[model samples]
Structure formats: structure tokens, C-alpha cells
Target: MSARFAFNHATAKFWDQREAVEACARAGAGIGLWREPVQEMGVAATAKLVRDAGVAVTSLCRAGFFTDPTPAALEDNRRAIDEAAAVGAPVLVLVSGGIPDGGTIDSARDGVRQALAELAPYARERGVTLAIEPLHPMFASDRCVVTTLNEALDLAAPFAPEAVGVVVDTYHVWWDPQVWQGIARAGREGRIASFQFADWVTPLPAGVLTGRGQLGDGCVDFKRYLAEVDATGFTGPIEVELFNDALWARPGAEVFAETKAAFERVTA
Candidate 1:
């Protein structure tokens, strides 16, 4: 078993949270938690569940949407930071929201910067790193505006590395020609708050958000990614986050077994 393997809750979106944590515990794998379920189960209960199971909480997904940066938005992010802290998750993934009705992409990017400035200090105080996740460019208009690892790193640059960092998710960064360089740079700057795995497959399903390919099922070179990230001296959990509708429709235990096997195969 790979000591670094972790299963992201989104990989089995509809699975029961307790069952997921239990599965991770049995496998000696860490777990990435989602906010909705955590809130559903109550933060304290979820914390106790994982603690009793001895399952590591690798990272929390998600708490960004900072393009607008209203007071309400910033408040929500702070709550997210607290949740991450309570769950013992060191990082909280952030997805910059799309451009507002009157804002341009540049302005939206600025909003992200401003929001980080306001949130980084709070996050640092809580011992949580706010990780900026750059979604693919296609999502810029409606999902996320930060579209590359370099851009995410730049957004994180103004803050202390521990307070703000970038998430290197393969589904979003694999298309970048300079991805390897960005990975190396992230390592050098110690800004890699989280490292995630997902593959790219052709003929993407409608609404590409759920089209993430399983490990070894697409074009991404996992071995190379693992080698590069490992060379950076990042010995943290390696989370596999898939958003495939097909997988979500299956029994979560079955999907977990298959995905774990795929991870071992690809990383082997």
C-alpha cells in the first residue's frame, strides 16, 4: 500500500462521510474532506470520527469564490479556515469565482488578490494554509478565473508561504507547457500547499467539470508528475480527486477499491 495515497471525497461524491473515513482508515490512506458533508455531520462530530478512526485529514475542499470578495464571501472563507483547523487538515483548497457581472478578468484576478490579503492572516493564525486552485481556462467565465499554476503562485506570492500556497492539480495544470517549471518553482518557494491527481481524457463529457479521468485512464503522465513533485521534497499526501459521473453512480466502496488499485498501478 502507498503510504501517501489519499482519497478525495469528491471522488465518491455521494458516499456517506463516515463510511468514507472508515474506508480510508482500513486502507491506511488519508482522506480529503468536502465542506458540505462536514457541515452536514457537524464539524465536531466529523473531527471525532476521523480522530477515532485514526484517519488523517489531508486537505479540505473548498472555500474560495473570492472574485467578488464581498464581506459575506470573506466571512465564509474564515469559517472554512476554522473548519480545516478543527479537522486537522493543513490546507484548504480555494477556487476563485468567475468574473462578476461588471468585472473583467483582470479585475476578477485583483479581487482574488485582495481577498487573499484579508484572509491570509486569519488562516495563518489558525495554522491553516489557504491553497489557491487554478481551474482550466474554459472555466474562467463561469467557474474560476485563476487558470494556471503560475497565476496561482503569483496570487500567493504576497503572503507568507505557510499562510497562502498553490494547489497543483493535474486536471487543471497538465495542459500548461510550463507546468514542470511551475512545479519546480512552487517547490523552491515552498508554496505547494496541496498536490492532487486527475487525468485528462478526450471527448470530454458535457459540462466538463465532472470529466476527470481515473488514474492511468488518460493522457496525464503520473509517474513523471510523482517524480517531479517528489524531487521537490514534498512528502505530503497524494490525493486522487476524480469527478466522474459514472464513478459517482456506483457503490462507493467498489469505486474506492478500483480507484485505489488504479492509483497503485499508475504510481507503481
Candidate 2:
């Protein structure tokens, strides 16, 4: 089980990219990368760094704030797909942008559908899968409007599974009564592109952007989630992707070590 643990860069938002890669390499773990750090390091350089370190990049953090789907947004998503390919990451996790200006939630969802149609083929051609992530409903207004696995799957259904898929992040979907059924559906359709883990804690902080709880410090049932995902024949990295501000304030190496331990404990 430990062999499948992966560290997502955002968990240690302030860590140096090179150091993070080295740490993952030492632990014999995979990594989930974010676009900004990759861009700052130069995609080519980052690719070589991970390659040389013998670290596998499980997925790329994002590239889908296209509720408006402007020409620039589409182009940026295209670049993200390209970057994922360069870094040897098979999945590009996408968070559909919230409601656009003057648009209702329904309209925003339609925009997501349009954006995926335009970008799925591009992603496929680059050998990357666009994995749509549904945030918790509380975030439906500003961070992501697609707030359930079922909704995400509906958006992905039009495209080939190879081109589009969904992310099953524990923090966001653990409360959904229908999540199990949704996971089964995603698996049967061969659309489980990414499986991320983040615990859900109560009394969410102001804005709630970076309040993801550490693995065992909250309410998530990691073992059960593992069982369901494993039953799906999805044998991929289980990325630890917390967004806690407290973790960010600490030294990254310390957070990384602690997170790795917690992951092993919870998932063991």
C-alpha cells in the first residue's frame, strides 16, 4: 500500500520543486505536480529533474477554469496538456471554474461541457487525460460548480474515456450518499483518471480554500475509500493533496514527512 502513496506538491505549497522531487524519490513514491512550479522551473527542466530523480509524476494539478471558455483559456488548457505529457504525467486534474460573469450555475455547467468538447481531443492527442474534479458543494459558487461525481461523469460521458475522466478526491465527495455508485460507474466506464485523498474537518476556516485536513486528523475513512477504488481495478497512485494553511506555514520537508506517515497509517 505504501508503494502507491504519492505526494501532491500543493500539500507543501511552499516547497522547492527540486527538493520535493528528491524527497519523493527517496521514499520511492510518485508525485503530483502543479503548473506554476513546473512553469517556473521550465517544463523541460522539470521533466528532466523528475526523470533523472527516477520519480514518476502521477498527475498535473490543473488547467480548466474555463467556465467562460475564452480563446485564451482553451489555449492555456492545451499548454497544460502538453506540459503533463512532457513531465510523463498521465493525468491532468481539471477543476471547472465557478459561475461565470452573468451566468447561472446551469450556464456555467454548459460552459464546462463546451470547454471539454474543445479540449478533450487536444488532451488525447498529447497522451494526457483531462480529469474533471468536483469540489464540495460549498465551493460550487467560486471554485468549482461541478460539485458531484455524477455531474462530472455526465460532463465526461460525451468523450472517449481515454480523452476525458474524473477525479475522486475523498475530501470533496466523502459526504455524497451516492458516491459509491458514482465510483462504480466511473470504473465500469473506465474513466477513473485520478484518485486523491484529503480528509474533511469541521469548522472550516475563513474562505475554506486551504483547510484540507491531514490524513487521519479528520473524518475521512481512507481504508473504505481505498477498498472501493481498488475494487474498480484502478491500481494507481493515491495522491495526498491537502490544502491546509497550517501545513503550508511549517517547513515543507517536515510536512512531507508527516503526511507520508499519516498516509501509510490511514491507508495501511
lDDT of 2 by residue, 43-153 (tens): 999999999999999999899999999999999999999999999999999999999889999899889999999999999998899999999998898879999999999
Question: Each prediction's TM-score against the native?
Answer: 0.99, 0.99
Residue 236's lDDT in candidate 1: 92
- Error in Å for residue 180 of model 1: 0.8
Instruction: Give stretches of model 1 more than 4 Å off.
Output: none
Q: Please, what are the lDDT tens digits per residue for candidate 1 over residues 173-255?
A: 99999899999999999999898999999888895999999998899999999999989989999999999999999999999
Q: RMSDs, each prediction?
A: 0.7, 0.7
Residue-level error in angstroms, candidate 2, position 142 = 0.9
